[model samples]
Target: MNHDTDAMFRTLKPAGLDTTVAEAHARRREQDLAAAWDATGSGRGVSAPAARRRMPRVLVAGLAAGAVAASAAFVIAATDGSGNSPGARPTASGTVRALDARAILLASADSAAKAPLTTGAYWYTRERETHFVAPMKLTEAQQKEVDRKLGTRLKGKTKADKSSPVTAWVSHTQESWSGRDRHARTIVGIDPKIKFASPADEAKWRTLSESQRARLQLDVPAEPHVNNYDFSHAKLLKTDEEKQVSALAKLPSDPAGLEKTLRKWYQDERALEMSLDGRTSENSFAAYVFGEAQDLLAGPLTPGAKAALYRVLAEQPGIRYLGTATDSMGRKGAVLALGTNGDDTGPIGKNFEIRLIVDPRSGRLLAQESGDRKAPSLTMTYEAMGWVNSLGARP
Candidate 1:
């Protein structure tokens, strides 16, 4: 394996974005609490607004899908007014100017309250992930280690850190479906061909022998891998939607019970990803839960469950509202974001932001994305969701 493969592997793990979005909001709440702390300590209140953050530039490619329910296209333009995106557009002030983040979410909750439950034989969701790679050099020892692990000799000229770097851009399409019966399928692979971002990188790749490229996994002919899962009973899928939605249906529509249940679910998922305990502070756990809520939406969500989700998010701190913009699928929606700085162990070890895109008109979620100024970013646009009578059917 070359430096590119090493870098890609490094990027395949869950990172600080999960914490950042959660922590960013947690810090805001802390500040509010700290104001009371200050008053108690010095007999005077200290007021400070959370720092305004800038959204990173994002490049969303066009999406094309075969027969599917709901919308198929996904596209998100940069909201920073940087003019760096082809999808960027000036926000129309007349309609959205009066709406704040909380107002937007409240409206969303109202919309969700009226939404209907969907039932089908299968639930389908299609999305795309784009990875941006920069030029990198690999040492000879590093190349040998990669070769040893793969049991194949890499045929590339090895050089130290000072050599010319090679880089490529790639995108992957992922499709997943869960059935009302007892089956689930996920297909993931690079859909479009990989392209060298820099012409110099392209030239460098062309200089390599075809065998070397194959060993390096630099060729675009590779197929994406598929993973299939089947469950004999819905109880086996109880970790997520199956559990949460079912619980929501039993709980009262009041916010307190709703919040407690959702928070418990968040704690459960967080425990799976990281170690935490009674002493562990709940810094952006709510934000993390907000991000995770989309997965439940892909399944069946009752109107009360949907409204509870929006209401919980409306109360969370650190959610920044960016006026309407198009997701990668070309659907217009309002954008809310939270994030934190990336560390050495984190994937995309640069500062990144996680954004939730919600349909402004219907208050339905459209997409979610995590991106940074450097390194690759991931955006998941929900094309179509709902139950179908059969595996291949769409609703």
Candidate 2:
């Protein structure tokens, strides 16, 4: 219905890939799109939760961590978009109801517009996630070398534990804080270990008749010594943070203007980033849109900016309305789907998707989840956001 919106969506999709493998790599890259926002401390003004110095590793490692399977789809549409029939509305805690995705998003836009404008000395986000990990093969010497380089010893305690690679379903609580001109800081805490001993154990596990790992209650080891940590050493220059913050603060509040401005912002960011490497790719559009959405949700935003962001999302192609659902934190909200619209027509075609969970009453973002449904899912929740006067302060 809206040509401008349609153009924006078209602009976001990368041109067709040369090979199925290329397509797979692109989809895999899309999963990490959100993490880039968390790691970028320059150009566009959003700061990763850690200093700029750690940019490369944070982007690469964080995004690669949770490659998992998606849960069953939670939202189902109840009505076809038609003027003759009003969509069904369900009462809270009652049966599922069908509603148009556009309507839900527009309603959210109105709600977002009414939210109070907020900012803080620091931009803060907190998240808790559960994901699976397959062990890496490292000899004793190699493990020691890794610890030497990282300044931390990470050996398994028992001889058997050290010899075997571990398969784990790890749960961790993480927090990030970004302030003007200072490095972003991140703190991470892990739950007690739920390890599968080693890859050998997992290999042997395959011989079992049932592959449902959930059926077996695994043992929880005490928190590993190297797991609980905090870091602020990454360097984020004030000038860079200020430049990005200034740019973000200046974004237009209307959808058309917002789209235009964001496109330019993303372009400039990519150019700045790629100028160092002397290579550039045009297929980054869709991924940039996804990353920008995550960035705005985590960064300082006025109510107007928030409203515009929601409207932008509502306009994107393949953004489906999945009705009410709860986040990993057990917060109930409506969910919207993006990137997951693709099917397995090509290699790794259906491997990427992002789900945004938002509070219907206030249009506040509750959480963002992306990655494969069958692998380790990466979920980041907006546990806290707002203007605070101090870096370590919580809003």
Question: Candidate 1: where are CA atoms >4 Å away?
Answer: 1-97, 134-166, 187-191, 203-227, 233-254, 270-283, 340-350, 373-376
Cα deviation in Å at residue 253, candidate 2?
Answer: 2.1
The sequence of per-residue lDDT tens digits that candidate 2 reaches over residues 260-369 is 87777667766765664454433345455654565676566778877888777767665665545455555555566655333312112344455666665677777665
Residue 328 lDDT in candidate 1: 57
lDDT of each: 0.49, 0.49
Query: How well does each candidate superpose onto the true structure, as a TM-score?
Result: 0.58, 0.57
Q: Against the true structure, whose TM-score is highest?
A: 1
Give the per-residue lDDT digits (tens) of candidate 1, residues 1-395.
69999899769856777778765654443333222122211111100000001111231110001111122122244342332222222233211123356756766776677777655556666665544433333345534433442345536544322122455544566666665555766666637456665587798878877666554445554677667666654454234553532343454356676788777765765564354222322336655555555555444666677777778778877666654556555655666766532121122222345666776446577776554422323456666666556654556
How far does residue 258 in candidate 2 sit from its true spot (Å)?
1.9
Q: Show the lowest summed lDDT stretch of 10 residues, model 2.
A: 40-49
Q: How many residue pairs clash in each candidate?
A: 13, 21
Lowest lDDT sum, 10 consecutive residues, model 1, at 43-52
Predicted structure 2: lDDT:
0.49
